[model samples]
Target chain A: MPSNIIGWARLIAGVLGLSAVAYIAVTGNYLLTALGFAAIYVVFVAALNLFMGHAGQVSFGQNAFAAIGGYGSAILTANHGWPPMLAMLASALLAALVALVVGQATLRLRGHYLAMGTLALGLISYEIAVQWEQVTGGYMGISGIPPLSIGGFAAETDRQVFLVLALAAVLACWSVWRLRRSRFGRAMGAVAGSEEAAAALGVDVARTKVITFVAAAVYASVAGSLMAHAVGYISPEVFGLHMVVVGFTMLYVGGIGTTLGPLVGAFVIGMLPEVIRGFRDVQDLVYGVVLILILIRAPGGLAGAWRR
Target chain B: MPEATLLLQFLVTGAGTGCVYGLVAIGFCVIYNASGIVNFAQGSFVMLGGVVTYSLWHALHLPLAVAALGAIIVSVALGVLTDLLVVRPLWHRRATMFVMILATLAVQIVVERLTLIVVGDAPMSLPPILSRGPIHLGPIVLDTQVAFIFAVSLLLVAGLRLFFTRTATGRAMRACSIDRDAAALLGIPVSRLVAVGFALSAAIGAIAGILVTPTQYTAYNLGVPFAISGFIAAILGGFGNPFGAFLGGLMLGITQSLATVAFGAGTRNVFSLAVLLIFLLLRPQGLLGTAKT
Candidate 1:
């Protein structure tokens, strides 16, 4: 396919995909409930890719942002009786704010130190989510969340929610595409390729990294909102280390910088368990083994392979 | 307990726990010094050493000495595989130092969980090869923890010293750590020796695990604490110096014990974390490594 055709095809597929999801809502396939999960993870991987793939900052705290988003959205809609739209927006903004705070302290560190700083941030968030009982509902999670509806159309089934979530994911990918072509995105690329070299060229290296961090956090938060809406509940487990691994896997496997890579990664990982429902015991081991193999052969990720 | 008694008890505990941390931290220092990458899976190696030893000796009915030997050998294999599968690939790809760390984390998680699946979720216990009775003085009591802590940590450190100082391969490993290109030019097989560094680090992890298991027992949950504690201890000591790691580990033990008395035993982790947090925020280059990318 022509490069331009590939771009157009991706756009058309996204729109049509949303319509199909809407059709799934009308038909109500319980198995398609898994797609809601895939959509959520797609957003998650895109967020991580923005930081690690594009901006060259490796953060283990996408799960933190997801937690912030999950709790922020769930509490607002579940307890405060806010509209879903407002709750989602608030959660995204909250994640961005958190990103800002963490960025200020950690952006100074580089290489291994930076990874540790972010990992620490992730651990601290885990502590807070686990320890803070009243607001977060502690380990048990906040359940009985009301499903979101567009105007009069209430999401009575997982299909409806999946459709909406998928659209959000598409928008996330669109944003990734916009970023890949933008000057800011190019600057992020420059930073990732070489920070000192970018600094020598007088790029605002620190600012660029912090901004990318905030953007990635926002993306993760938005995805978390959709995830909260889909399950009609939010829990601290959704933001744990295992979830972090899932995000990392999707982002890395999706090939990092490629706009479409996360979509591929999310589908493979999200759908794999459901696809091969058997061998539940060995699935994680298998996934891990496959991921390691992929890393060894395709360190740049699946997108890296495609690019090559 | 009287204040003096508590202090002495804590000192013993610190020495015991500190000894284990120091051993693990020494491994971290060796690997970091050799290969500029902080192997986050160092804890997994420790856990693996313990778990494998537990399985080999108790479950598979192997002799304790044979089990320990098997554990050490397997751990060395893991270290070699980690290098081949994760570290060498990232290095080969010319990945940023940060990316290699990320890869290690990825590998660590995989290894840690695989240990859990294989060993089962419950903590593993083995009968001590040596006696583990507590000997109480008038006010202060000492147990196997205190008695063996020094014997294990210091002996390993001393043994490592002799190996490095006396043997050609050991000195070659040290030289390779300093400058791989120059070491290779000087006719040392840099890649082979660096892999050896990984093997030795794994062996240290295994030995430390074996020594500590009689007191704390072996569990999958130990990996995170081990990795973080070892890293922080190594960082405290200055990332490359084994002696520094020994001091750093003891200091952590002291802080943890003191913090336990002051803030409550439950807050001991909070104490360890707080110290590392302070270090990260202020003096990150550490006692040995010095701050540089």
Candidate 2:
């Protein structure tokens, strides 16, 4: 049939996302606190899909960028007196810079070693965030974060920042979708599938990996910055390997090699705990179980269940 | 204490932790050798042994030795369950290597949390009678549990060497590690041997857990870091060889302890893993790698 099915799903999801925002705006149901969480997660996981799904980089450090994002935004706004809007962009840049350094150093590794090497970077970033006391506030975390706002009125009014985040998520998804169709995206994928083969065909393997990795980090960072603002708090624990695991799970459960996979995974997982309150205790457990089930049963993911 | 005594003391303490890592690393090697599957849940198995033993020993009032034995037995059983339930199904379907990684993670999360539900989230401990006695060696001081942990670990490693060298079953396991199909053709029950591989892996993991818990205590999330370190050790010593894994474990542990002293104590994990990464860059197979497929 037509690609209209995918379009309809996107439209319905957008409306639902907007309505969820409106519901929070009107009802002030702080349970939607998780909406901001979900929105930010969508941004991060979607960016992660660019590297992991499209480019074949099994990175576990997307959360490190998110950690950087939160801290970057927090520092810019909380300490440097930057506006919330400006702080967001700054966080993305900060994450990008760090990712650039890390990707360059570790991308030379092949196979599972590459995976391990990047995971090491993620762990170290997390440790630095925890141990570097005065800057990161150590383990207790940097708190009292200012919320995103339009003009004068604050965006901290419950679900308001989340509304903005959801809108941003839509834009990020659209941009990534467009990018996937771009020449650079194809080049990245080619490199991921076979670096030696791609190099033989004139692809600059190392540079492509570095750029793709940095771009992913930038996206994750911006999402993290928004999350810090939305939550009005940021913690070192938020940057741990668990976040990395969750990010990868979301991307893989949705579909690794597709444009929409991360978004769907992020949405489902993000909204899941909110759908049933008791599920909060075992939110991670459900995530793990469902993700494994999906990985096994539908290797191509939920969207992949439909054959062309 | 004298400098030599202090050095000896740290080594004693460090060796216990190192041996546990070695055992855990060996467990990782066994599975990796048998199926070419890197079992990231090796740490979870260690935690299970520690937590289960702690529960059975304290809550059920079993003898200490019996509790330790029970822990090994339970870990071995869980290893069987892991292979049969999670691994076998995945292996049967010939799931992608990536999916197998996630499946093992699923097993780890399920087992780890189920443990939290059974035992509380707090650090589970043994009786002070087992936990708080010490042994004096020259001018060096060693805790009773720590001393036993190191001694037993060395003994186990030596015993494993003999068993592998001397026994027919062990030789078959070795043969399978070389080539599964070839070993199967040589009248070896490859599948059963793989199960035994899991059993052996889990036993070592559990033994490490019992030794560690008296000192470090046990928690649901306890095994994760160990798994990461042990995996590093396995890589550092090559993926298939048990002795290389042991050396990797000791080197990693000593380096970690020294790294902590050099660059603040809390940042030890970062330094230790950094060392593993650096080592991997220099030698992809490992430091003392074995020649196996």
Top-DockQ structure, candidate number:
1
Model 1 chain B lDDT-worst window of ten: B284-293
lDDT per residue, candidate 2, B142-224, as tens digits?
88877777788889899889878899878888888888889888899877777888889999999888888877788987777
Fnat, model by model in order, equals 0.33, 0.29
Residues A1-308 of candidate 2 have per-residue lDDT tens digits of: 23688766756766886676677757867756776677788888888888877887767567788888889988888878788888888778878888888787778765555665665677677778878898988988887789896578777655566668778888888888888889888888789789889899888989998998998998888888887888788888777766766776777667777767777778667777776565333766676677667666677875565333
**Regions of candidate 1 where Cα sits further than 4 Å from its true position:** A1-28, A79-83, A132-138, A149-153, A278-281, B61-66, B126-129, B264-270, B289-292
The prediction achieving the highest lDDT against the true structure is 1
What clash pairs does model 1 have?
Answer: B238-B287, B238-B288, B239-B289
Query: In candidate 1, how many Å is residue A249 off?
Result: 1.9
lDDT of 1 by residue, A1-308 (tens): 43686566666666785576566556777657777788889888888888887787888767889888888889999999988878989888888898998787778877666776677667667777877788889888998777876677777665567777778788888888898789998898899889889998888999999999999899888888888888888777678777777777776687777888898788668877777785533555556666666666776675666555
DockQ for every model comes to 0.46, 0.45
Instruction: Say which candidate scores most in TM-score.
Output: 2
